[model samples]
Target: MSPATSRGPKTPVDPNAPGPMLRYQSNLPKLPVPRLELTLQRYLQSVRPLLSDEDYHRTEQAVREFEAPGGLGQQLQQRLVARAKDPKIVNWMEDWWLDQAYMGYRDPVVVYVSYFFAFKEDKFRTVPAKRAAAITTAALEFKRQVVENTLEPEYAKGEPLCMDSYKYMFNNCRIPKKPSDVAGMYDPFKNTHIVAIRKNKFYIVETVHNGQQLSTNELEQQFQQVIDNAGHIPALPIGALTAENRDKWTEDREILLAAHPENKAVLEKIETASFVVCLDDSSPVDRDQLSRACWHGDGRNRFFDKPVQFIVFENGKAGFMGEHSCMDGTATCRLNEFVCDGLNRNKINHGSEQVRSGLPAPQQLQFQVNDKVEKAVAEAEQHFDELIGKYDLTVLAYQAFGKNLIKKFKCSPDAFAQMVIQLGYYKMFGVSRPTYESGQTRKFQRGRTETSRTVSNESVAFVKAMENPRLPNEVKVAAFRAATKSQGAYMSAAVNAHGVDRHLFGLKNCLRPNEPKPALFTDPAFAYSQHWFLSTSQLTSEHFAGYGWGPVVSDGFGVAYMIKNEALQFNVACLKDLVVGGKTYKNAAYHLKQCLEDAANELRDMLIADMPAQAKL
Candidate 1:
């Protein structure tokens, strides 16, 4: 009678899993043959720094490991090599490790950090989703007005390869409610683990419990146990690899049963992946508390926070911040969808068919973006004097970051008031602003005698005529108005009420009704920490993939990351070291916040002063 839970065709198991789980060995992909890019000592230098403890004894031990007679020579720990060899599973695991290898290979500090995540609760519940969707459709339809405005088309050739290399991530992995829970450090002993795209798909992997490694048969049985227990994934349409012959494919991983008929159970065992509901929210953690969670050991001032955090407010409400480390805008949206699915009990009945497979292989990044942005930066100065004052600050910061990734450049601590003020433009005597229909319906009325339509309208625009280098003052106002008017009208109405004897109204505005209203004065806080966007994890939409992370411990869910290339991507996984009010951002956070406000307001005043004194004179 209740809505049937969707497990979708997989053989059912008792909700209460019964009996012993099996064990299995996974064959791993071959690592690229080592060509020795650097000397043993240098390689040791690279991996040594990863271990924060600099005790001469431990450092000496590592150096010896590096200098072993035949070279560390991928003499991967014998047990590790053996355990990492399950081809089907290990191949995917290798690709996952590549995506996460930015910190260092074999860095235990980064590996063991990914263990947990808090439940994510939806926070933006106030917005009416149905209405928001409608508005999105309308805005996107203005496709004719907006341009692609891409900076470059192809940054690297191997990008697709890199994307394809990790098809497993696209298929079997989902960004968790917090990526840090699975990032940095990994424990080979954990039982059940999940990854996701939030509200889209959830990939579940139940490892054979205890310290014993699994054999393919054991793994197959355990996978079945999961299918028997995890409930059906509605849209996921989980495959019943249990049909026995799935593994007989001579050509690689085709559904084993599709090839051979009798071995269905063994193949189906591996195909037994399941999905859960979507997670539905992004919210900030306590800034102060989180800073304390990500700290380097031995009183060191620098702390590598795990780019994301999760915390419960005093009211027992759960919230999280996507630390800027593990994810960027491009990566966050995919994650947000995964979390949403978990919160909503949504499952990937459908495969991860829509997304990029992830970096399939090694590739280069487009370093030219800086050049294009540089041109834009230069032009900004000529059009708006705001750049004149910022010429020093903007250029300096950009260059500083380029030169030193680790240095912290603290702003002046001196206090100063900052703000932004808006003044509406007027015709003839004052300035004018561009107008795109603005307003909303106050209320709807329905009565036999009352008019069939209720109208709400307000028209306001800003117009500023500035003297061009070659153009005369007399043409300024007219030129400005013409430029603004070029943006044509969007709404056209016909009198539907003509036959009914009353006017029927339909209105469309560029700025949607019920959306966050535009406020001239922004809240004074740090220049939004670049991490404010962290709480809005899974920022990606359709175009790009963004992600980042730090290799450190955090008891307070410290490090946070955010990316906003096109859509948005972000993640907030916990760590044991980063703590709130730590030096990373807190050192000069308040100072920068003040500077940004002052900077914007100062630019505004400059614009007013630069306007032509007499329009059409």
Candidate 2:
């Protein structure tokens, strides 16, 4: 026995799916982090399958396009140098990365949140809506973060912030699919389809914010109000941009379609995909009639009226439409703050009177990234570039052991984390320890550039631990001491310190050159026991679960990380097709359960032996 498994949860019940109930435990306390983090997600990044040749060529093409003359790259470069700005293509590219690397983990994770809204007609038309948010804050935060921290250090000196995180562009590779390639069968197990878009560039429109959220509906109505008072987009950034002064990017559908360049590939990708839906049952939401008419604009489901709208498509399909460009998932949970700051404070009281006359408002403060880390990143890129010359490998990937895989783990979170680091090391070099089941980090390197690939991260369960009352004080002490001690030691060690420093560059310089760089050097070998007791309800909704949008059901996965109690629960999921069996999910589920049970038993015995007196029931 590994020392962390439960001895039947103190009270009798079953381990399989829901049916009749039995009282094991409830309303018990829990371990801090959820099972998802410990198992499916160790937090940094996860391993993915090897990339196909088709994937590489499409990706390489995107890298070249970024170099297009007077194109997005140039626009971004100009912006960094105080000349121009473009967040559209940048944002779009990121959305693509979420599609691939995170394996569409960026796709909407259908959340059925219960809410009752007070209706304008005085009747609360409360409805249960499906909601989704970006699971990869890393992708959304890429541009801003690179700008804030690691870019200048890894990038060549003098390179534009426009190209700072160019590493992200490789994320756009995927031979664009036609909707026909995947119609009607896009079940929960699948993601992505052909993207449909109107090429009329003139009809395309954009608006930037300076300091506030711009509500389009409110902006349209308040064009006169802002003119009547001091103007802007009612829900937009403070840099008031009324529609009268704005111009529609296109007018004719022909131009819109023609405007988007087509290769034999891109033309195919949008065949099934639809444009970003912007219409509300009755009409297109257009706010251009107000202000000086600088730009013109226009364009769902029976969604919700609240900021967090959820939609449950047929057969477990779901989607989320969030109007937040600046807010993150953390901020989304705090809806009241957004309401106060985004809507109420500046309703129709403002609009057109504040519109800029020419060019556009000067950008707000932009940070200067560090030079050293940029150098290191450039070095890493160069390493991959050099490797490409020496080897013809086409795909790269990494894998880490999960709770079920390790039968005899002491089961401390710190030890589990160290095991992940080891896995990453093993993937890159094909080396793993005898106790590999304890958790090991692995990485596969098979690219010319740093764009290895991304896929949906799945099967992370985050159930709280240590919430049971039957567990003795001695058992509690043994588990707590081992887990905490290991966590603190790793937290204080050098390798983790390097990670902390490498990741913390933008905030303030903490490490000086030639200083002892922190490290964990080697995985720990010990006889400490770690285990936990947890609590559960009749139903549980996993947090941060879903894949990125992609074509074919063959490419979907989901993971939830939460605490079950003293033990961490990581529930991993993938397309039934992707698993080893012809279509049996039980393979993965049983693998995890058996692996966890073994580890728990071993740890319990170890702790019992370590006690001064036999601690038993």
Candidate 3:
């Protein structure tokens, strides 16, 4: 079965069971160790296209010498296998990966570690109060399922995936520190309130009263009260400081905390809340507008520490912002899908339309910001405006074809889309370079991700053939098939924890002090190839109008694509100053849009020629 197919849970599950989500948790497989020989072979295949012939020969020699029977590669592989087999270690790479890939890095989270979703507008509920109330009601239902441990586990290809990350879904915050960051999880039972931010003012709204969640009408009433009370009064914009770099923000946080003794209490309340609901004061119409609205409001209006923040606009549109430190996109994607699905299907309780009188009002949380904090907030807001302004986002809702057409030709939709990306980059740059695509390893316990190096010699050949006007359609089609097959094989290997990148990472980290660094690690091609020029991933959902994050490197493009039945959507982002071959990456959105349409059409035409004579006629 393809990785896209979901097999049912490994063990039979009872719908009424209390711990349904955990039924097969203990039985999940441990991450595997790839054979050293197979890894070296895959590594060579992946890196060949990125290097010159001479460099490729040198790298090949380095690999052969490193893989000798008594060499360092052999020794490190043994150590890695032994570590994986250690009785106490659930997954050998989890902690090290979490730190190096996410937390320990010191870039600003807005453009790097944070991701955003642009939600479809609610036509039925045009008022902000009504929309906010309904979304909160639906979100609380999801929280109840997770907190009660009754939510069904997710699966891919009929195999149960790890559910450990869901525990950090609610009531979690990523706290900043000097050299690193740490995550804290508040007990969901104790943190029953949601933090609502509007006009740079914070309010706490209790979801439960008299042993039941607030009715939708009551929640709306509370929201209305907050709007009326806050009354467009401008506060000091303390939340804006969060958009700064970690090291800078850490210092700013201290100043705010020392501004007043009560300021610390306010910070704690926002951090410990179950989740955040930002009632953005603007209305957005299209994908770009909605995405920017949800991505980040005026920096002053957001508290970025919470892992999940639901942003609802005045026009009743909503989306989510995720702090990407403690959890990966898969977990949050599932959470958002569940919440939106509940609302769509009416499975969530809308409660009575009648408002209950005399309920406790939402409490306003205020901080004391002195001159130092005031200046810092101004600087943060300025930086945020300048930073996000540099990013240009465009949505390619390609209506000509989608997964339906790709699957008709017996192709994986994801692999087909990936090829389109490669061809698109080659069209713009006249070269194939290192590309990064995220691969899930969640079949194992606490597994997060493995890099599925997307560039290969087959892919390069395919793109070159497609771009050459002298080539026949048959030749291009053959190259396309070969490239997709190569992609599928590597993806399968990655899902099984046999991919070369992570394995190499583990081996290098375990090297003994006396051992000399392997020549393979020091190769210029190794460094150049790992510097991804195109970082792409696919996470599709019907609930979102658009979703994506900024590029990982300055010169790279963050290409996040979603495949729906009738169309494909892409959210392409990059830095303002990024340029390649004298063309600015800022203009890549337009170029990519044209390239995707062209590639899809060109491939469709080629496939049509392969049909039987009668069918074609």
Candidate maximizing lDDT: 3
How big is the positional error of residue 434 in model 2, measured in Å on the Cα after superposition?
Answer: 11
lDDT of 1 by residue, 1-617 (tens): 01223532122322332211100001111221112222223223322222335543454464454336664323332223343344443221233333342222222222223221223333432222221222122212221111121111111111100111111211122112112223332221231222111111223333223432232233333333333333433221111111011121111123222444543443222222211111222222433222222111111111112232222222223322232223332222334334444334433222223323221211111112233333332332232232111111100011111101111111110100000111111221132211111111101100011111111111111123331235443454344333223211111111111111111000001123554422211211111111111111112122112122322322111112222222111222332222333423322222322433343333234333445555212
lDDT of all predictions: 0.23, 0.23, 0.84
Q: Write the per-residue lDDT of candidate 3 for residues 1-617, one digit (tens) a residue.
A: 12323554555544454597777777788888889899989999899989899999999998988899999889999999999999899999988887888778777788777888777766777888888888889888888888998887887777778888888888888777888778878899988999998888999999888777899899999888877877877677877887888888888889989899999889989888999988878878888788777777677778887889998887888899999887888888888887787787778888888877768899999888788888889898888888888876667777777777777777899998899889888887889989999899998889888889888889999999998999887898899999999999899989888898898889888898988989988878778767878888888888788888888877788888988787888777776567775776657766776787777777778877865566544
Better lDDT candidate (1, 3): 3
Per-residue CA lDDT of model 2 for 153-243, tens digit only, reads: 2111211111222222211221112211111111111212211111110011112234332223222222222122322222111011100
Q: Could you list the CA RMSD of all candidates, in the order they appear?
A: 28.3, 23.3, 2.5
Considering only N, C-alpha and C atoms within 3 Å, which residue pairs clash in candidate 3? 5-157, 6-157, 6-158, 7-157, 7-158, 8-158
Best by TM-score: 3
Error of 3 at 200 (Å): 1.1
